[model samples]
Target: MTVDQLPPAPAGSPPPARPGAGRTLIRGLGQLLITAGVVVLLFVVYEIWVTDLFGAQKQAAATEEVDEAWAAAAQTQAPQTDTVVVTDPAQLVTDPRERTPTYQTLTGQGFAKISIPAFGADYQFTIVEGTSDDDLYVGPGHYPESQMPGEQGNFAVAGHRVSKGSPFNDLGLLNSCDSVIIETQDDWFVYRVLPMPEEIPTWSSTAPTRPLCADVSVLPSPYEQTVGREITLPSDYAQILPVPGISDATVPADAQRLITLTTCHPQFSAAERMIVHGVLTKSYAKAPGFLPPEMGEA
Candidate 1:
C-alpha cells in the first residue's frame, strides 16, 4: 500500500511510536520509580517512629520486672540508708575491691535502673544485662565485660540514639559535672561527668563553672584522655576498659570507679560512636521514701 494510503491506527487508539512500545515502556518505568519512592518513605517512617513505639513498650515491661525483683528482695533485706557520712567526694569507696549489690549475669534481663538529672526527672531506663541486639532492643544494654555499678572499674553501657526508644538521644546535651545516677537493689550510686578536655587544664581553677566537676581531680592520669563527651569510631573498645583508654586489664590499686555511656553518633547513623565518661562522686544508701539530693540537680 502507498505510504499515505496505509490504514490509520484504530480511532481512539494511541498512535505508533517506533514500534508502538516506547510510550508503554516509559509509563511502566515511571510507575516503578514512584512505587520505589513510596517504599523508601514507609521504611524511614518505620525506623523513626514505629521502632520508638516498640522500644517504649519493651522498656516499660523491663522496668516492671526490675521493680518486682527489688520489691521481693526488700522483704528479706533491710534498706540501706544514709549510714556512711561522705566526707570526700573523691574517695567515696573505701576499698578498691568492695563491690556493692551483687549483679545477675543473665542476658536480656533488666537488673539496674539509670536516671540522668540532665535528661529530666522522667529520664530513666532499666539497664539490661547484655549488649546484644535483643537486650538493647529493650533499653540500655550493659557490657558484660565491664565491672558492676559502684565497683572499682568502668561500668559501661550502650544504647540506641535514633531508634529503639533512643534512650541516649540527648546524651550530647550532658555537660561536665552532670549526674548520672544508677539505682541498684540496695543503694543509689551517683557518677558525675568528667570535665571536657578543654576544661581540664582549668578544671580546678574554674571549679565554680560546675562546682561538682572539681571532684574529678581524683581520677588518675590514665583518665585524662577520657572526656565528658567524645566522638569515636565503633572499633574503639578501649573506651570501656577498666581504666578507660588503658587497654590492659591491670587496673590501678586505687582505680577510680567510673561509668561510661556509648551510643551511635550524629543521629540516624552508626558510622561513629559517642562516648561519655563519669566518675563516682556520691553514693546514697536507699531508704524507704528516700531520694538522693543529686537527683534534683539541673
Candidate 2:
C-alpha cells in the first residue's frame, strides 16, 4: 500500500496505550510517605530527649525555691507555749468549719526541706491549709479539720503520691514503724508507726479515731462525728482508733491523738488509699546535737 492510503486504515479508533499511569501514581505516594515518616521521627526525638531534659532542670529549680522559703520560715519565731487543755466534751466540735484555726508552713530542717530516707524523697516543699480542688498539688498541707502537729488531737497531712514533684511518692513503701518527721519553725516532730488497716471506708463509724486526748474536752473535733469520718489526723492517734480492715480487733479503741498520712494506694489509681499511722514520741526544739551521721545538712 502507498503511504497516503495507510492513514485511512484506522479511521474508527486507536489501540489502548500501556498502563504507565498506575506506576506514576505509586511513585508519588511513596515520596509523600517517606517525608511524613521523617517528620514523625523528629518529633519523637524532641519529646524523648529534649523535653525531658528541660523538665528535669525546671524541677530542680523549683526545689531550690522551696528550700529558701523553708529557711526563712524557721527564722521567724518558736512555736508559742500554749498549754492546750481538753475540756467540755459536749462543747467540742468536730466539724472542720467550726474551730478557730492557725496555719503553719512545713519546711526542711536547715531550710524548708523535706526528705524521706526510705523513699529517697529529698526536696524543699511548702505546707498550706485546705485540701480543696485548688490545693492538692505543691506539697503536703495541714487540714484545718484536724489538729495541729503538736496538738493533742489527730494531725492529718495529705500529699500527692505520684507525678515528678510528688512529695509523698515513697509513702507506699512505708512499713509499720517507719519514721515520718516534720520540721517546722520551732522543732522537729518525730512519729513512730502504729499497726493499722490499709483501707477504711470513708463512711464507716470506726474509720476516724482520736489519737492524743489527755481529756475529752481537748478533742480537736466531736468524737462521735469525726471518729469514722474521712478526715486526717496525727499518726499517733491512729494506733488507738483503727477502722475496720482485714483485721479490726488488732486496732484499739482507746487510741488517741492519731497522726495519719494518706496518699493514693496502688500508685496511680484513686480507687483506694494507702495510710501510714504514727505516734508522736519526741519533740526536739533544736536540731538534735546527735543526728545519725547519714542525716546530712538538709
Which candidate achieves the best TM-score against the true structure?
A: 1
lDDT of 1 by residue, 139-254 (tens): 99999889888888899999998888889999999988899999988778889988887887877678766556656663557666778889999999999998888787666777
Compared with the true structure, the alpha-carbon lDDT of candidate 2 equals 0.47
- Candidate lDDT (C-alpha), each: 0.83, 0.47
Instruction: List where candidate 1 sits over 4 angstroms from the true fold.
Output: 1-19, 79-99
The TM-scores, one per candidate, come to 0.85, 0.47
Q: How close is candidate 1 to the true structure, as a TM-score?
A: 0.85
210-282 per-residue lDDT for model 2 (tens digits): 3322111212322333322232333323422333121232323344445666776576667666665565554
lDDT score of model 1? 0.83
Model 2 stretches astray by more than 4 angstroms: 1-114, 121-125, 196-255, 287-298
